[model samples]
Target: MKKYNCIWVLLCCLACVGTTSCSDKKSSADEQEKGVTTVLPDTKNEVTTQILKKRTFAHELVSNGKVNARSKADLRFETGEVIARIYVKNGDRVHKGQKLAELDKFRLEQKLSQAEDALLKA
Candidate 1:
């Protein structure tokens, strides 16, 4: 009885393997047939082609945004003196130790004289 049971299980396993192999071959054949079928574009559709030519193309961009500088500096005078003249305008490029504006020389001289007098008095 045990031998018969073992034989029965072996037969069932063999049948399953055979069916699986046959299905695999059928699927491969179907794939081959599908691969051989070429899909052509619609003949009714129209396509226009232009000859290649060398030409310069210019691209212009128009945008609106706030631009921030990579580096910024806050300019100020050591003494509270009026500005007499400005040499450069806003958004102008500057270098180190460059004079951007001049102080009122008349007022500065007056202040200097006053300080000298006060020092003498003291």
Candidate 2:
């Protein structure tokens, strides 16, 4: 009876070892079949193209007070006459050589006539 008990214990231990080893073998086989590996490929030989081009970007800004430019100046009429007609309002975008406002033509002609008379008298 003692020998039979020892044999039974040995068989139980062998059975547990066999089951664990089979599971480990199955997992290793699965990993091999799936091509799962920890090694990474080298990326040092990759080439990329970068083209240089012009791009335009726009942004909006909000302010409470009046904004002034560093080189801004007030435009005044040389003859000190009232404005006859305004082509643009305040804060309107204008370009170089663009007509913004026009002076009274009659007033300008009168000034020109006065200048001419003065020159004639001189």
Q: Which candidate is the best by TM-score?
A: 1
Best of the candidates, lDDT: 1
Instruction: Show where candidate 2 strays beyond 4 Å.
Output: 1-73, 117-122
The whole-model C-alpha lDDT of candidate 1 against the native structure comes to: 0.89
| Candidate 1 structure quality by residue, lDDT tens digits, 17-98 | 9997777467778888987967897778679999999898888999999988788778899988889999998888888888
Q: How do the residues 25-67 of candidate 2 rate in per-residue lDDT, one tens digit apiece?
A: 6766887879965777776676899998878767789779978
TM-score on alpha carbons, each prediction: 0.42, 0.34
Model 1: what TM-score? 0.42
- Candidate 1 colliding pairs: none
> Measured by C-alpha RMSD in angstroms, how accurate is candidate 2?
12.6
